[model samples]
Target chain A: MTQEAYRNRVKAAAPKSPLGKNIVMAFLFGGGICTVGQAFLNWYLSMGLPQKSASSYTSMTMVFLGALLTALHVYDRLAKHGGAGTLVPITGFANAVASPAMEFRAEGVVLGMSAKMFIIAGPVIVCGTLASIFCGLCYFVVR
Target chain B: MQTLFIKTPVTVEAHAAVVGKKEGEGPLRDCFDLVAEDIFFGENTFEKAESKFVSQAINLTLKKAGLKPDAIDLLFGGDLLNQCIGTSYGIRSFEIPFLGLYGACSTMAESLALASVTLSCGQISRAIAVTSSHYYSAERQYRFPIEYGGQRPPTAQWTVSGSGAVLLKNGGRGVRVTSVTIGKMLDFGITDANNMGPAMAPAFVDTLKTHLKDTHRKVSDYDLILSGDLGSFGMEMARELAKDEGIFLGENYADCGCLMFDLKRQDVHAGGSGCGCSATVFCGAILPELESGKYRRVLLISTGALMSPTAIQQGESICGIAHAVCFEGE
Candidate 1:
């Protein structure tokens, strides 16, 4: 059979991911994570911290929780069920940075763990930086 | 003819399978010779643990055959690791003449076929074929880190963390290697690395068709037709493709991936995969069934995807190959 014919067959035969269920789970879980962050921010603000400092502390706390869950190997399990829920949160970024560090730790400290620490998050950082610089240039030219 | 009919009787003397904690909880849990509670198998790293799994399987097979490692004239093995390091390190302490293979998931069938051919040539007296794959090692190499909170699609298959070893002798009273049909690489334009079932189904169908044609045998000639690691989706594709060619794959047809786990209970999305999937399933389950006269004649076609992470990223379609080995009961 031609490759095109086979591709069509594969498209038909392949089982699709449950988009409806996944969206529901992602919304609920993602919202729940954000709610927790908001709760942390509220707690900090109640302690007389400024709004910006409260927000920064909340993000740090969420990242710390993400890294902790990843170390405990609970984040991956949650991500499996949560889909984008665990990933869109700061916890997901923490997992993206921490997982490879733990996985490649056996290779050595420098080349293995340290080097591979950003294997996944590296692309995000690079792209984000480049985009930010481009936006900054656009803003300066517009002004 | 692509198929080689072995004139000299080459029989499977002994075989053993060792699986990890997750696989031990599978449906075929009791079939395995050893189910390690520790995923590391007492090793420091997952890679080393995979090598240890291969070693344990070889040791168990040797003990079952009541022969020392020196008695084996040649050893054929491989795995999914880079440079086939899993086999190299796993079998290093044996001090046996080794031939490392890299047929991807089809390494078991490739090694077995080569070992059978060598033994049938009357030069080698005894040979062993072994292969292994670890979930963590394969994941880190092919997909992502273990703790990465990324969701896998439904088509994704769980790599079996296990190893299987089989001892073959020149002539013995057991299941004998009857013939083999080596396959050609076929690419069907499948680029999704996560969906290996369809990517490899064409190769399985091609090899099965070639084997049947060259051997002048019909599908009904064999009691069972088994494909390695095609999972449910790939098996359906194979059956459909075979039907298009006017070949019927009936109730006797099964895939090692589908049989490796309980699909509903096990949470293995598509099923079990990797080199160890077919190897462990054959050694732990099918061989025993064959020995007990449950199956008179069986055909095993192990299919493999030949695409690397680099090739996939470069927008190349996955190429698949399969090797068919026919075994008959005495």
Candidate 2:
């Protein structure tokens, strides 16, 4: 049942639905999310950012924004609908990181969520950033 | 189809693996290659466990059955994917003609039934029916992992990811698939992928009734009857549903799901749900007993809940598939 897994559930809950509205709410929330992403992308572009820079800015803005919302449990509330919509984008990763942290939120910032929250995502970020940087450096060296 | 008797099953093999933090509990699952430490060590373990399982199963089954490489005519098998990449991909390494098949958990039985009929019809002298699955592959592709600890409702039946093979050939002093009863999976519009037991129960009942009717055998005719991975809940539901159909599968009836996990220990909540779940038990435990002539007759009902995440999200009822293979000793 980890946030990382989107499907197979071994210790799954008793079969039942959370009901009608939860599904519809997914679309409503998903549209709002994309609209926010668009707004951020526009704002970054308006500030005279280059295309790649604006893209990175938008991606980061959405991820961070998703992280904040996920921390607040708002994205989880919206996950029932967008199917993978809300969860597939950067927000899903944030939710993956934040939900676990939020669960241990009461345990405090250091030992609880902050430590274990990024257990799944922390290395992903580190390795990804490091890999990208490494590739860039390799290109410069070859050039 | 007419009857063609085969002695020993040509092949039998099994493997299981656990990824991330989940404990590998089942007797067979416990023996799997643990990916937790490897993933921890930055190993692209990926299908290592599953691939190992396929190789081990083929090797074991071939060894136990005393079959040479060239003896196997055609291999029939499949998995959870629409294209059945799992079985086909792993089987690519083995140089054998294969016809991929899928009936979900019932795949083993379906393949067996087809092979039985094929032998009966004298199309080929021998054939191997292999089916497999893995928790990690299934989880990565199908549902959430334990790391996320996502909340799942009861309706979902865990997708079983294990493989099992049954070899059928000419005469021997072993158990032969005497007859087969095939059931069409029916979806009653229940869309909850989590609680697949209930969605699949009706299919079990319908097929059981069909088998008994076709064979003209009573419930007591067979010494033992095992359903593929219907799990504990489906076992209960099948019993109840059978009562309505004037059949009672009580004393000797068992399920792969119930046997796969100690619900109390892992709090598995349900029972084991995977292709290998039922296939392993059928080939490993049940087939051995059948070979020993412990029972003059046995009925193996492999069950399957054919539901995917897309189906559930689309709000579609689940379909259940079951294939009954009658094992009779000479």
Fnat for each predicted structure, in order: 0.97, 0.12
Question: Candidate 2, residue B221: CA error in Å?
Answer: 1.1
**What tens-digit string does per-residue lDDT give for candidate 2 at A19-115?**
5654665567667778888898899999999989998989888889777876565665556445555755677787778666755554478896577
Candidate 1: stretches off by over 4 Å = none
CAPRI quality band, candidate 1:
high
Whole-model lDDT per candidate:
0.93, 0.66
Among all windows of 10 consecutive residues in model 1 chain A, the one with the lowest summed lDDT is A8-17
Clashes of 1: 0
Decoy 2 TM-score against native: 0.66
Pairs that clash in candidate 1: none
Q: How does chain B of model 2 score on TM-score?
A: 0.86
CA shift of B330, model 2, Å: 3.8
In model 2, what lDDT does residue B89 have? Answer: 70
What would the per-residue lDDT of candidate 2 be over residues B66-145, giving only the tens digit for each residue? 77657778877776654777677767777888888878778888888877776666666777777777665676556653
The most accurate candidate by lDDT is: 1
